[model samples]
Target: MKHTISALVKNRPGVLAESSTAFHNNSINITSISCGETENMEVSRMVICAEGSDEDIAKVTKDLQAMDFVIKLDDLARKEFVDRELVLIKVDVNKDSMSQIMQIFEVFRADVVGMGQKTITVELSGDQERVEGLIKILHPFGIKSMCRTGMIALKRGDE
Candidate 1:
């Protein structure tokens, strides 16, 4: 199983490191991590993923919340949130296919971020399914390189 955990912790040195070390000690492998500040200097949102059964994740969550620097924690299951991923892809291109490639990008609302003699880099941000779909479409055109900012998610309703 995979769990998406949102942690609000004190924005101080060693807080993030200690929290991550706790997860590590529990044998949880972090699949993704992203964090940013909020209005409160002592609080920041941290998103993380790891493979663990719900029970195991809950235990980890409890441990995390008990940490001195942690302020709040939420486990977002499939029901309560929207998640998205961003990816940059560099695809092989030629003059003959340039227009066609542009059309494809237009259809997906992907931006052409950079270009070289043999490649064009596209930047795309969307739901996971949509991003994966775009990648599948671009594969036939020869993807030279790609980078992904793994899934970021937030609660859906007013909270």
Candidate 2:
């Protein structure tokens, strides 16, 4: 199973490295991770997505919460939260396929961020399902390149 976890840590230079090392030490199998400063620049939120058994996830969560640098920790996978990821994909294009691709772009609400004669780049942001749907649909267009950001999440309602 996949789990989403977040840790709030002091926005210091070594926080990220140390956090990741802790995961490594615990043998936590991470799938995606992202860290960035919150509105208050003094703190950073690290969002980690990992695959593990229930017991393993519990251990990881407990271990992460006990870290000195971590101010707070939450297992978002079991919380009422929403998450999104951003993807940029460049696909082969030509006059004959332009309209079809454009239609798909509209259907997916993807933006044309960059364009070339032979290829066109698009930006799409959504939850994993929506993002993966777009990529799967665009596969026939011949994906030239792609970039994706790790999932970021916020809980719903007031805490």
Best by TM-score: 2
C-alpha positional error of residue 68 in candidate 1 after TM-score superposition, expressed in Å: 1.3
Poorest stretch of ten by lDDT in candidate 2: 17-26
The 10-residue segment of model 1 with minimum total lDDT is 71-80
Q: Which stretches of candidate 1 lie over 4 Å from their true place?
A: none
Q: Model 2 over residues 15-81: C-alpha lDDT tens digits?
A: 8777777777777888999888898889899899988888878877787778788998988877888
> TM-score for all predictions?
0.86, 0.95
**CA lDDT of each prediction against the hidden true structure:** 0.87, 0.90
lDDT, candidate 2, at 32: 93
